[model samples]
Target: MTINLTLRQLELFTATMREGSFTQAAEKLRISQPALSTAIRKIEVELGLTLFDRTTRSVQPTPDGRHLFAVAEDLLRDFKVSMQGVAERASGLHGRLTLAVLPSVAASILPRALMQLQRKYPGIDVAIRDVMHERAVAMVADGLADFAVTTRIAETAALAYDEIGADRIHLVCRDDHVLAKGKGALPWSALEGHAYVAMAGSTSVRRLADAVLLQADFALQPRFEVEQIASCIALVSAGLGVTALPALTFSMFASDRLTMRPLTGPTISRQIGFLQLKGRQLSAPAVALAGEIRGAYGKR
Candidate 1:
Protein backbone atom coordinates (compact mmCIF):
# COMPACT_ATOMS: atom_id res chain seq x y z
CA MET A 1 0.00 0.00 0.00
CA THR A 2 1.13 3.58 -0.70
CA ILE A 3 2.01 5.72 2.30
CA ASN A 4 0.46 9.18 2.75
CA LEU A 5 2.47 11.58 4.89
CA THR A 6 2.64 15.35 5.25
CA LEU A 7 5.73 17.39 6.18
CA ARG A 8 4.02 18.48 9.37
CA GLN A 9 3.48 14.84 10.39
CA LEU A 10 7.14 14.02 9.77
CA GLU A 11 8.19 17.12 11.70
CA LEU A 12 6.04 16.15 14.69
CA PHE A 13 7.28 12.55 14.65
CA THR A 14 10.96 13.63 14.63
CA ALA A 15 10.41 16.27 17.30
CA THR A 16 8.66 13.82 19.67
CA MET A 17 11.39 11.22 19.10
CA ARG A 18 14.08 13.84 19.92
CA GLU A 19 12.34 15.14 23.01
CA GLY A 20 11.39 11.64 24.37
CA SER A 21 8.04 13.07 25.51
CA PHE A 22 4.86 14.12 23.60
CA THR A 23 4.29 16.89 26.16
CA GLN A 24 7.80 18.37 25.59
CA ALA A 25 7.60 17.95 21.73
CA ALA A 26 4.20 19.73 21.62
CA GLU A 27 5.59 22.55 23.75
CA LYS A 28 8.56 22.96 21.32
CA LEU A 29 6.22 22.76 18.28
CA ARG A 30 3.67 25.22 19.81
CA ILE A 31 0.81 22.63 19.82
CA SER A 32 -1.33 21.02 22.56
CA GLN A 33 -0.11 17.69 23.97
CA PRO A 34 -3.46 15.97 23.15
CA ALA A 35 -3.29 17.23 19.53
CA LEU A 36 0.24 15.89 19.13
CA SER A 37 -0.86 12.51 20.60
CA THR A 38 -3.78 12.31 18.16
CA ALA A 39 -1.52 13.06 15.16
CA ILE A 40 1.01 10.40 16.28
CA ARG A 41 -1.77 7.85 16.80
CA LYS A 42 -3.00 8.56 13.24
CA ILE A 43 0.57 8.03 11.89
CA GLU A 44 0.80 4.66 13.76
CA VAL A 45 -2.60 3.54 12.38
CA GLU A 46 -1.56 4.48 8.77
CA LEU A 47 1.75 2.60 9.04
CA GLY A 48 -0.01 -0.37 10.80
CA LEU A 49 2.89 -0.51 13.27
CA THR A 50 3.34 0.26 16.94
CA LEU A 51 5.85 3.16 16.95
CA PHE A 52 6.39 3.79 20.68
CA ASP A 53 6.35 1.93 24.01
CA ARG A 54 4.59 4.25 26.43
CA THR A 55 4.55 4.09 30.26
CA THR A 56 3.57 6.53 33.04
CA ARG A 57 7.25 7.51 33.49
CA SER A 58 8.80 7.50 29.96
CA VAL A 59 8.24 7.09 26.14
CA GLN A 60 10.66 5.06 23.95
CA PRO A 61 10.82 4.30 20.17
CA THR A 62 10.38 0.79 18.77
CA PRO A 63 12.46 -0.49 15.76
CA ASP A 64 9.89 0.87 13.29
CA GLY A 65 9.89 4.30 14.91
CA ARG A 66 13.71 4.47 14.81
CA HIS A 67 13.75 3.64 11.06
CA LEU A 68 11.07 6.21 10.16
CA PHE A 69 12.78 8.88 12.29
CA ALA A 70 16.07 8.56 10.38
CA VAL A 71 14.38 8.79 6.95
CA ALA A 72 12.14 11.73 7.89
CA GLU A 73 15.07 13.73 9.32
CA ASP A 74 17.06 13.28 6.08
CA LEU A 75 14.05 14.24 3.93
CA LEU A 76 13.48 17.44 5.88
CA ARG A 77 17.17 18.42 5.53
CA ASP A 78 17.16 17.81 1.75
CA PHE A 79 13.95 19.79 1.27
CA LYS A 80 15.46 22.79 3.05
CA VAL A 81 18.50 22.75 0.76
CA SER A 82 16.39 22.39 -2.38
CA MET A 83 14.19 25.32 -1.42
CA GLN A 84 17.26 27.54 -0.82
CA GLY A 85 18.60 26.80 -4.30
CA VAL A 86 15.24 27.64 -5.86
CA ALA A 87 15.15 30.95 -4.01
CA GLU A 88 18.67 31.85 -5.16
CA ARG A 89 17.90 31.09 -8.79
CA ALA A 90 14.66 33.10 -8.70
CA SER A 91 16.55 36.10 -7.31
CA GLY A 92 19.26 35.90 -10.04
CA LEU A 93 21.89 35.18 -7.38
CA HIS A 94 22.69 31.83 -8.99
CA GLY A 95 22.01 30.72 -12.57
CA ARG A 96 23.45 30.31 -16.08
CA LEU A 97 23.18 32.57 -19.16
CA THR A 98 24.04 31.87 -22.80
CA LEU A 99 24.68 34.65 -25.33
CA ALA A 100 25.28 34.76 -29.07
CA VAL A 101 27.25 37.84 -30.15
CA LEU A 102 29.01 39.24 -33.20
CA PRO A 103 32.78 38.94 -33.00
CA SER A 104 33.02 42.72 -33.26
CA VAL A 105 30.91 43.37 -30.18
CA ALA A 106 32.50 40.44 -28.37
CA ALA A 107 35.96 41.88 -28.78
CA SER A 108 35.13 45.56 -28.29
CA ILE A 109 32.45 46.24 -25.66
CA LEU A 110 31.38 42.85 -24.34
CA PRO A 111 34.39 42.28 -22.12
CA ARG A 112 33.70 45.40 -20.06
CA ALA A 113 30.03 44.53 -19.81
CA LEU A 114 30.82 41.05 -18.54
CA MET A 115 33.18 42.43 -15.93
CA GLN A 116 30.38 44.54 -14.54
CA LEU A 117 27.96 41.60 -14.57
CA GLN A 118 30.39 39.40 -12.70
CA ARG A 119 30.99 42.02 -10.05
CA LYS A 120 27.29 42.40 -9.40
CA TYR A 121 26.21 38.77 -9.77
CA PRO A 122 29.20 36.58 -9.20
CA GLY A 123 27.14 33.44 -8.89
CA ILE A 124 25.86 33.66 -12.46
CA ASP A 125 27.76 31.69 -15.12
CA VAL A 126 27.92 32.91 -18.71
CA ALA A 127 28.55 31.17 -22.03
CA ILE A 128 29.35 33.14 -25.18
CA ARG A 129 29.09 32.09 -28.84
CA ASP A 130 31.10 34.69 -30.73
CA VAL A 131 30.03 34.43 -34.35
CA MET A 132 29.17 36.44 -37.44
CA HIS A 133 26.01 38.53 -37.48
CA GLU A 134 23.94 35.95 -39.37
CA ARG A 135 24.86 33.06 -37.08
CA ALA A 136 24.19 35.24 -34.06
CA VAL A 137 20.65 35.90 -35.20
CA ALA A 138 20.08 32.24 -36.08
CA MET A 139 21.12 31.11 -32.61
CA VAL A 140 18.51 33.33 -30.98
CA ALA A 141 15.80 32.33 -33.46
CA ASP A 142 16.46 28.61 -33.01
CA GLY A 143 16.51 28.90 -29.20
CA LEU A 144 20.13 27.75 -29.10
CA ALA A 145 20.95 30.94 -27.25
CA ASP A 146 19.20 33.10 -24.66
CA PHE A 147 19.87 36.28 -26.62
CA ALA A 148 22.25 37.90 -29.14
CA VAL A 149 24.29 41.04 -29.62
CA THR A 150 24.45 41.73 -33.34
CA THR A 151 23.33 43.95 -36.22
CA ARG A 152 19.86 43.68 -37.76
CA ILE A 153 20.15 41.77 -41.02
CA ALA A 154 16.47 41.13 -41.69
CA GLU A 155 13.04 41.27 -40.07
CA THR A 156 11.99 37.94 -38.60
CA ALA A 157 8.73 37.10 -36.82
CA ALA A 158 10.59 34.87 -34.36
CA LEU A 159 12.96 37.54 -33.10
CA ALA A 160 12.80 41.05 -31.61
CA TYR A 161 15.56 43.62 -32.14
CA ASP A 162 16.55 46.42 -29.77
CA GLU A 163 18.91 48.98 -31.34
CA ILE A 164 21.59 50.11 -28.90
CA GLY A 165 24.08 51.92 -31.14
CA ALA A 166 25.60 52.17 -34.60
CA ASP A 167 29.12 51.41 -35.75
CA ARG A 168 30.53 53.50 -38.63
CA ILE A 169 32.33 51.75 -41.46
CA HIS A 170 36.01 52.59 -41.83
CA LEU A 171 38.68 51.82 -44.43
CA VAL A 172 41.41 49.60 -42.92
CA CYS A 173 44.89 49.46 -44.44
CA ARG A 174 48.54 49.00 -43.48
CA ASP A 175 50.24 52.07 -41.98
CA ASP A 176 52.43 52.32 -45.09
CA HIS A 177 49.45 52.18 -47.49
CA VAL A 178 48.84 55.36 -49.48
CA LEU A 179 45.31 55.83 -48.08
CA ALA A 180 46.62 55.73 -44.50
CA LYS A 181 48.94 58.71 -45.20
CA GLY A 182 45.95 61.06 -45.49
CA LYS A 183 44.97 62.97 -42.28
CA GLY A 184 41.13 63.16 -42.25
CA ALA A 185 38.22 61.03 -43.53
CA LEU A 186 38.84 59.53 -46.99
CA PRO A 187 36.32 59.78 -49.85
CA TRP A 188 35.08 56.67 -51.67
CA SER A 189 36.85 57.77 -54.89
CA ALA A 190 40.22 57.08 -53.23
CA LEU A 191 39.53 53.29 -53.47
CA GLU A 192 39.33 53.42 -57.28
CA GLY A 193 42.32 51.40 -58.45
CA HIS A 194 43.44 49.78 -55.15
CA ALA A 195 43.34 46.03 -54.54
CA TYR A 196 40.48 45.28 -52.09
CA VAL A 197 40.56 42.50 -49.51
CA ALA A 198 36.88 41.69 -49.17
CA MET A 199 35.23 39.68 -46.38
CA ALA A 200 33.27 36.62 -47.49
CA GLY A 201 30.09 37.61 -49.36
CA SER A 202 27.99 36.07 -46.58
CA THR A 203 29.17 38.46 -43.86
CA SER A 204 27.28 41.55 -42.71
CA VAL A 205 30.47 43.63 -43.15
CA ARG A 206 30.77 42.50 -46.77
CA ARG A 207 27.12 43.28 -47.47
CA LEU A 208 27.46 46.82 -46.14
CA ALA A 209 30.77 47.30 -47.97
CA ASP A 210 29.24 46.15 -51.24
CA ALA A 211 26.29 48.51 -50.78
CA VAL A 212 28.58 51.47 -50.10
CA LEU A 213 30.73 50.66 -53.14
CA LEU A 214 27.66 50.39 -55.35
CA GLN A 215 26.30 53.68 -54.02
CA ALA A 216 29.64 55.39 -54.84
CA ASP A 217 29.49 53.85 -58.35
CA PHE A 218 32.97 52.37 -57.84
CA ALA A 219 33.76 49.28 -59.93
CA LEU A 220 36.75 47.83 -58.06
CA GLN A 221 36.78 44.03 -57.63
CA PRO A 222 38.26 42.13 -54.66
CA ARG A 223 41.81 40.82 -54.77
CA PHE A 224 41.22 38.45 -51.84
CA GLU A 225 38.15 37.10 -50.06
CA VAL A 226 38.50 35.89 -46.45
CA GLU A 227 35.95 34.47 -44.02
CA GLN A 228 37.39 35.56 -40.68
CA ILE A 229 38.07 39.06 -39.34
CA ALA A 230 41.53 37.95 -38.19
CA SER A 231 42.39 36.85 -41.74
CA CYS A 232 41.27 40.18 -43.14
CA ILE A 233 43.35 42.00 -40.54
CA ALA A 234 46.40 39.82 -41.35
CA LEU A 235 46.16 40.49 -45.08
CA VAL A 236 45.78 44.24 -44.53
CA SER A 237 48.64 44.30 -41.99
CA ALA A 238 50.88 42.48 -44.49
CA GLY A 239 50.08 45.13 -47.13
CA LEU A 240 48.34 42.55 -49.38
CA GLY A 241 45.22 44.76 -49.82
CA VAL A 242 42.86 47.15 -48.01
CA THR A 243 39.41 46.26 -46.57
CA ALA A 244 36.45 48.12 -45.10
CA LEU A 245 35.15 47.15 -41.65
CA PRO A 246 32.95 48.56 -38.92
CA ALA A 247 34.64 50.67 -36.23
CA LEU A 248 33.65 48.22 -33.49
CA THR A 249 35.64 45.44 -35.19
CA PHE A 250 38.78 47.55 -35.31
CA SER A 251 39.48 46.45 -31.70
CA MET A 252 40.81 43.16 -33.05
CA PHE A 253 43.52 44.80 -35.18
CA ALA A 254 46.91 45.86 -33.93
CA SER A 255 47.14 49.65 -34.04
CA ASP A 256 50.91 49.63 -34.78
CA ARG A 257 50.40 47.80 -38.10
CA LEU A 258 46.94 48.82 -39.32
CA THR A 259 45.15 52.20 -39.51
CA MET A 260 41.46 52.89 -39.92
CA ARG A 261 40.06 56.04 -41.55
CA PRO A 262 36.37 56.90 -41.53
CA LEU A 263 34.70 56.39 -44.93
CA THR A 264 32.98 59.53 -46.28
CA GLY A 265 31.22 60.81 -49.42
CA PRO A 266 28.06 59.37 -47.86
CA THR A 267 29.35 57.68 -44.71
CA ILE A 268 28.06 54.18 -43.96
CA SER A 269 27.19 52.57 -40.63
CA ARG A 270 25.38 49.50 -39.28
CA GLN A 271 22.97 49.27 -36.32
CA ILE A 272 24.11 47.16 -33.39
CA GLY A 273 21.63 45.73 -30.89
CA PHE A 274 20.12 42.88 -28.87
CA LEU A 275 18.15 40.11 -30.57
CA GLN A 276 15.83 37.93 -28.49
CA LEU A 277 12.70 35.89 -29.10
CA LYS A 278 9.50 37.93 -29.26
CA GLY A 279 7.11 37.54 -26.30
CA ARG A 280 9.71 35.60 -24.32
CA GLN A 281 10.70 36.83 -20.90
CA LEU A 282 14.43 36.80 -20.14
CA SER A 283 15.86 35.09 -17.05
CA ALA A 284 16.98 37.37 -14.23
CA PRO A 285 20.64 36.83 -15.09
CA ALA A 286 20.01 37.53 -18.79
CA VAL A 287 18.24 40.77 -17.89
CA ALA A 288 21.12 41.81 -15.62
CA LEU A 289 23.71 41.12 -18.31
CA ALA A 290 21.71 43.06 -20.89
CA GLY A 291 21.63 46.04 -18.55
CA GLU A 292 25.43 45.94 -18.33
CA ILE A 293 25.68 45.80 -22.13
CA ARG A 294 23.40 48.80 -22.46
CA GLY A 295 25.53 50.71 -19.97
CA ALA A 296 28.69 49.85 -21.91
CA TYR A 297 27.24 51.06 -25.21
CA GLY A 298 25.60 54.12 -23.70
CA LYS A 299 29.05 55.55 -22.98
CA ARG A 300 29.95 55.34 -26.69
Candidate 2:
Protein backbone atom coordinates (compact mmCIF):
# COMPACT_ATOMS: atom_id res chain seq x y z
CA MET A 1 0.00 0.00 0.00
CA THR A 2 1.13 3.53 -0.80
CA ILE A 3 0.90 5.22 2.57
CA ASN A 4 1.62 8.96 2.67
CA LEU A 5 3.51 9.98 5.77
CA THR A 6 5.24 13.11 7.08
CA LEU A 7 8.49 13.14 9.02
CA ARG A 8 6.84 15.08 11.86
CA GLN A 9 4.31 12.26 12.33
CA LEU A 10 7.08 9.66 12.27
CA GLU A 11 9.06 11.67 14.80
CA LEU A 12 6.06 11.89 17.11
CA PHE A 13 5.40 8.17 16.82
CA THR A 14 9.03 7.25 17.53
CA ALA A 15 9.29 9.66 20.44
CA THR A 16 6.08 8.39 22.01
CA MET A 17 7.29 4.83 21.66
CA ARG A 18 10.62 5.68 23.26
CA GLU A 19 9.22 7.65 26.14
CA GLY A 20 6.29 5.16 26.65
CA SER A 21 3.82 7.95 27.40
CA PHE A 22 2.22 10.86 25.45
CA THR A 23 2.91 13.22 28.39
CA GLN A 24 6.61 12.37 28.41
CA ALA A 25 7.09 12.54 24.59
CA ALA A 26 5.18 15.83 24.52
CA GLU A 27 7.57 17.18 27.15
CA LYS A 28 10.57 15.87 25.22
CA LEU A 29 9.32 17.45 21.98
CA ARG A 30 8.32 20.66 23.81
CA ILE A 31 4.70 20.35 22.68
CA SER A 32 1.39 19.96 24.44
CA GLN A 33 0.25 16.37 25.00
CA PRO A 34 -2.97 17.01 23.05
CA ALA A 35 -1.01 18.26 20.01
CA LEU A 36 1.33 15.24 20.06
CA SER A 37 -1.58 12.84 20.37
CA THR A 38 -3.37 14.56 17.45
CA ALA A 39 -0.36 14.25 15.16
CA ILE A 40 0.05 10.56 16.07
CA ARG A 41 -3.63 9.96 15.44
CA LYS A 42 -3.36 11.48 11.93
CA ILE A 43 -0.47 9.14 11.03
CA GLU A 44 -2.25 6.09 12.47
CA VAL A 45 -5.47 6.96 10.54
CA GLU A 46 -3.53 7.46 7.26
CA LEU A 47 -1.61 4.19 7.60
CA GLY A 48 -4.65 2.22 8.95
CA LEU A 49 -2.43 0.97 11.76
CA THR A 50 -2.97 1.07 15.48
CA LEU A 51 0.48 2.18 16.63
CA PHE A 52 -0.29 2.51 20.34
CA ASP A 53 -2.55 1.03 23.10
CA ARG A 54 -3.76 3.98 25.17
CA THR A 55 -5.09 3.88 28.77
CA THR A 56 -5.96 6.49 31.39
CA ARG A 57 -2.58 6.02 33.16
CA SER A 58 -0.07 4.95 30.46
CA VAL A 59 0.61 4.16 26.77
CA GLN A 60 2.14 1.05 25.17
CA PRO A 61 3.22 0.31 21.59
CA THR A 62 1.23 -2.16 19.47
CA PRO A 63 3.08 -4.99 17.64
CA ASP A 64 3.10 -3.00 14.35
CA GLY A 65 4.28 0.07 16.28
CA ARG A 66 7.31 -1.91 17.53
CA HIS A 67 8.35 -2.66 13.92
CA LEU A 68 7.76 0.87 12.56
CA PHE A 69 9.59 2.46 15.48
CA ALA A 70 12.78 0.69 14.48
CA VAL A 71 12.40 1.84 10.85
CA ALA A 72 11.57 5.43 11.81
CA GLU A 73 14.62 5.67 14.10
CA ASP A 74 16.97 4.62 11.29
CA LEU A 75 15.26 6.82 8.68
CA LEU A 76 15.50 9.94 10.84
CA ARG A 77 19.14 9.24 11.62
CA ASP A 78 20.06 8.91 7.94
CA PHE A 79 18.01 11.98 7.00
CA LYS A 80 19.80 14.09 9.59
CA VAL A 81 23.17 13.00 8.23
CA SER A 82 22.16 13.87 4.66
CA MET A 83 20.98 17.32 5.73
CA GLN A 84 24.26 17.89 7.54
CA GLY A 85 26.20 17.21 4.37
CA VAL A 86 24.06 19.68 2.44
CA ALA A 87 24.61 22.29 5.11
CA GLU A 88 28.34 21.74 5.01
CA ARG A 89 28.47 22.10 1.25
CA ALA A 90 26.42 25.29 1.38
CA SER A 91 28.95 26.74 3.81
CA GLY A 92 31.91 25.94 1.52
CA LEU A 93 33.03 22.94 3.47
CA HIS A 94 32.75 20.65 0.41
CA GLY A 95 31.91 21.09 -3.27
CA ARG A 96 33.26 21.57 -6.80
CA LEU A 97 34.62 24.89 -8.05
CA THR A 98 35.18 25.64 -11.73
CA LEU A 99 36.97 28.64 -13.22
CA ALA A 100 37.54 29.87 -16.76
CA VAL A 101 40.70 31.93 -17.10
CA LEU A 102 42.80 33.73 -19.66
CA PRO A 103 45.83 31.71 -20.67
CA SER A 104 48.26 34.07 -18.99
CA VAL A 105 46.34 34.32 -15.72
CA ALA A 106 45.79 30.57 -15.73
CA ALA A 107 49.54 29.99 -15.94
CA SER A 108 50.67 32.82 -13.65
CA ILE A 109 48.12 33.92 -11.09
CA LEU A 110 45.75 30.99 -10.63
CA PRO A 111 48.29 28.45 -9.45
CA ARG A 112 49.04 30.32 -6.25
CA ALA A 113 45.37 31.09 -5.69
CA LEU A 114 44.44 27.45 -6.20
CA MET A 115 47.10 26.36 -3.74
CA GLN A 116 45.64 28.72 -1.17
CA LEU A 117 42.14 27.45 -1.91
CA GLN A 118 43.18 23.83 -1.50
CA ARG A 119 44.87 24.47 1.80
CA LYS A 120 41.93 26.40 3.22
CA TYR A 121 39.12 24.29 1.74
CA PRO A 122 40.49 20.85 1.07
CA GLY A 123 37.11 19.32 0.25
CA ILE A 124 36.64 21.49 -2.84
CA ASP A 125 37.69 19.95 -6.17
CA VAL A 126 38.85 22.50 -8.72
CA ALA A 127 38.49 22.61 -12.49
CA ILE A 128 40.15 25.23 -14.65
CA ARG A 129 39.92 26.09 -18.34
CA ASP A 130 42.72 28.13 -19.91
CA VAL A 131 41.24 30.25 -22.65
CA MET A 132 41.49 33.63 -24.34
CA HIS A 133 40.09 36.74 -22.64
CA GLU A 134 36.86 36.83 -24.66
CA ARG A 135 36.17 33.15 -24.23
CA ALA A 136 36.77 33.33 -20.49
CA VAL A 137 34.10 35.98 -20.03
CA ALA A 138 31.83 34.09 -22.37
CA MET A 139 32.11 31.03 -20.17
CA VAL A 140 30.98 32.98 -17.12
CA ALA A 141 28.11 34.62 -18.97
CA ASP A 142 26.96 31.30 -20.37
CA GLY A 143 26.94 29.64 -16.92
CA LEU A 144 29.54 27.13 -18.14
CA ALA A 145 31.89 28.32 -15.40
CA ASP A 146 31.44 29.69 -11.88
CA PHE A 147 33.76 32.63 -12.54
CA ALA A 148 36.59 33.82 -14.79
CA VAL A 149 39.95 35.53 -14.52
CA THR A 150 40.52 37.80 -17.49
CA THR A 151 41.00 41.34 -18.75
CA ARG A 152 38.10 43.70 -18.08
CA ILE A 153 35.38 43.32 -20.71
CA ALA A 154 34.19 46.65 -22.11
CA GLU A 155 30.91 45.55 -23.71
CA THR A 156 29.83 42.65 -21.56
CA ALA A 157 27.03 44.39 -19.72
CA ALA A 158 25.61 41.11 -18.52
CA LEU A 159 28.81 40.30 -16.64
CA ALA A 160 30.13 41.98 -13.50
CA TYR A 161 33.89 42.48 -13.16
CA ASP A 162 36.01 43.34 -10.15
CA GLU A 163 39.50 44.64 -10.86
CA ILE A 164 42.08 42.35 -9.30
CA GLY A 165 45.37 43.28 -10.94
CA ALA A 166 47.14 44.81 -13.94
CA ASP A 167 50.02 43.57 -16.08
CA ARG A 168 52.26 45.91 -18.08
CA ILE A 169 53.22 45.25 -21.67
CA HIS A 170 56.78 44.05 -21.90
CA LEU A 171 59.13 43.59 -24.84
CA VAL A 172 60.08 39.89 -24.70
CA CYS A 173 63.03 38.52 -26.62
CA ARG A 174 65.79 35.94 -26.30
CA ASP A 175 68.43 36.87 -23.69
CA ASP A 176 71.10 37.34 -26.36
CA HIS A 177 68.89 39.54 -28.59
CA VAL A 178 70.36 43.02 -29.18
CA LEU A 179 67.38 44.73 -27.48
CA ALA A 180 68.06 42.78 -24.27
CA LYS A 181 71.42 44.55 -23.89
CA GLY A 182 69.72 47.85 -23.11
CA LYS A 183 69.80 48.80 -19.39
CA GLY A 184 66.51 50.72 -18.87
CA ALA A 185 62.97 50.49 -20.18
CA LEU A 186 62.64 50.13 -23.95
CA PRO A 187 60.81 52.83 -25.91
CA TRP A 188 58.24 51.96 -28.56
CA SER A 189 60.45 53.49 -31.20
CA ALA A 190 63.09 50.86 -30.40
CA LEU A 191 60.77 48.38 -32.15
CA GLU A 192 61.19 50.22 -35.41
CA GLY A 193 62.52 47.97 -38.22
CA HIS A 194 62.36 44.94 -35.88
CA ALA A 195 60.62 41.77 -37.03
CA TYR A 196 57.80 41.18 -34.48
CA VAL A 197 56.03 37.96 -33.56
CA ALA A 198 52.47 39.17 -33.02
CA MET A 199 49.37 37.60 -31.47
CA ALA A 200 46.04 37.64 -33.28
CA GLY A 201 44.52 41.15 -33.47
CA SER A 202 41.45 40.02 -31.47
CA THR A 203 43.34 39.29 -28.26
CA SER A 204 43.31 41.79 -25.37
CA VAL A 205 47.11 41.52 -25.03
CA ARG A 206 47.61 42.34 -28.69
CA ARG A 207 45.00 45.13 -28.57
CA LEU A 208 46.75 46.78 -25.59
CA ALA A 209 50.19 46.54 -27.20
CA ASP A 210 48.91 47.88 -30.52
CA ALA A 211 47.06 50.77 -28.84
CA VAL A 212 50.20 51.99 -27.09
CA LEU A 213 52.34 51.61 -30.22
CA LEU A 214 49.70 53.42 -32.31
CA GLN A 215 49.85 56.45 -29.99
CA ALA A 216 53.36 57.02 -31.37
CA ASP A 217 52.09 56.57 -34.96
CA PHE A 218 53.65 53.07 -34.97
CA ALA A 219 52.16 49.72 -35.87
CA LEU A 220 53.52 46.25 -35.17
CA GLN A 221 55.29 45.02 -38.27
CA PRO A 222 54.53 41.33 -37.95
CA ARG A 223 56.97 38.78 -39.30
CA PHE A 224 55.03 35.96 -37.72
CA GLU A 225 51.42 36.14 -36.51
CA VAL A 226 49.91 33.45 -34.24
CA GLU A 227 46.69 33.04 -32.26
CA GLN A 228 48.04 32.28 -28.75
CA ILE A 229 50.47 34.02 -26.40
CA ALA A 230 52.32 30.73 -25.87
CA SER A 231 52.86 30.48 -29.61
CA CYS A 232 54.14 34.07 -29.75
CA ILE A 233 56.57 33.35 -26.91
CA ALA A 234 57.70 30.15 -28.60
CA LEU A 235 58.47 31.99 -31.83
CA VAL A 236 60.38 34.68 -29.93
CA SER A 237 62.44 32.04 -28.06
CA ALA A 238 63.24 30.38 -31.37
CA GLY A 239 64.84 33.68 -32.53
CA LEU A 240 62.19 34.13 -35.23
CA GLY A 241 61.31 37.65 -33.92
CA VAL A 242 60.69 39.66 -30.78
CA THR A 243 57.17 40.16 -29.35
CA ALA A 244 55.44 42.59 -26.96
CA LEU A 245 53.12 40.92 -24.43
CA PRO A 246 51.79 41.35 -20.91
CA ALA A 247 54.29 40.45 -18.20
CA LEU A 248 51.86 37.78 -17.00
CA THR A 249 52.43 35.84 -20.21
CA PHE A 250 56.04 35.32 -19.18
CA SER A 251 54.91 32.71 -16.62
CA MET A 252 54.20 30.19 -19.37
CA PHE A 253 57.81 30.32 -20.60
CA ALA A 254 59.40 29.78 -17.21
CA SER A 255 62.13 27.55 -18.64
CA ASP A 256 62.58 29.45 -21.91
CA ARG A 257 65.61 31.70 -22.41
CA LEU A 258 63.60 34.93 -22.47
CA THR A 259 64.33 38.48 -21.28
CA MET A 260 61.48 40.93 -20.67
CA ARG A 261 62.04 44.68 -20.70
CA PRO A 262 59.33 47.09 -19.59
CA LEU A 263 57.91 49.16 -22.44
CA THR A 264 57.65 52.95 -22.15
CA GLY A 265 56.71 55.99 -24.23
CA PRO A 266 52.97 55.98 -23.44
CA THR A 267 53.23 53.03 -21.06
CA ILE A 268 50.28 50.60 -21.21
CA SER A 269 48.89 47.78 -19.16
CA ARG A 270 45.83 45.54 -19.21
CA GLN A 271 43.49 45.58 -16.21
CA ILE A 272 42.80 42.05 -15.01
CA GLY A 273 39.63 41.17 -13.12
CA PHE A 274 37.27 38.44 -11.92
CA LEU A 275 34.13 38.13 -14.00
CA GLN A 276 30.76 36.67 -12.99
CA LEU A 277 27.18 37.03 -14.10
CA LYS A 278 25.76 40.40 -13.06
CA GLY A 279 22.78 39.25 -10.98
CA ARG A 280 23.72 35.74 -9.95
CA GLN A 281 24.91 34.91 -6.47
CA LEU A 282 28.03 32.80 -6.33
CA SER A 283 28.15 29.64 -4.22
CA ALA A 284 30.27 29.67 -1.08
CA PRO A 285 33.22 27.86 -2.67
CA ALA A 286 33.35 30.28 -5.60
CA VAL A 287 33.35 33.25 -3.24
CA ALA A 288 36.14 31.69 -1.24
CA LEU A 289 38.18 31.06 -4.38
CA ALA A 290 37.68 34.67 -5.48
CA GLY A 291 39.02 35.92 -2.17
CA GLU A 292 42.04 33.65 -2.52
CA ILE A 293 42.70 35.01 -6.01
CA ARG A 294 42.63 38.58 -4.74
CA GLY A 295 44.98 37.65 -1.92
CA ALA A 296 47.37 35.99 -4.37
CA TYR A 297 47.39 39.16 -6.48
CA GLY A 298 48.26 41.24 -3.43
CA LYS A 299 51.10 38.85 -2.58
CA ARG A 300 52.40 38.87 -6.15
Which lDDT values do the candidates have, in the order given? 0.90, 0.87
lDDT of 2 by residue, 92-195 (tens): 87899789988888788889998988988898888888888878877888899999988887766698889988899888889999998967799988988888
lDDT of 1 by residue, 1-300 (tens): 999989999999999999999999999999999999999999999899888999998899999999999999999999999999899788787889899999889999999999998898899999999998878888988899999999875777888999999999989898899999968899878987898999998999898888888998876699999999999988888889998889988787677878789989879899999999999999988998999999998874
Best by TM-score: 1
Compute each candidate's TM-score over C-alphas.
0.77, 0.76
Inter-residue clash pairs, candidate 2:
none
| TM-score for candidate 1, residues paired by index | 0.77
Candidate number with greatest lDDT: 1
Q: Output the worst ten-in-a-row residue range by lDDT, candidate 2.
A: 247-256
- lDDT for model 2: 0.87
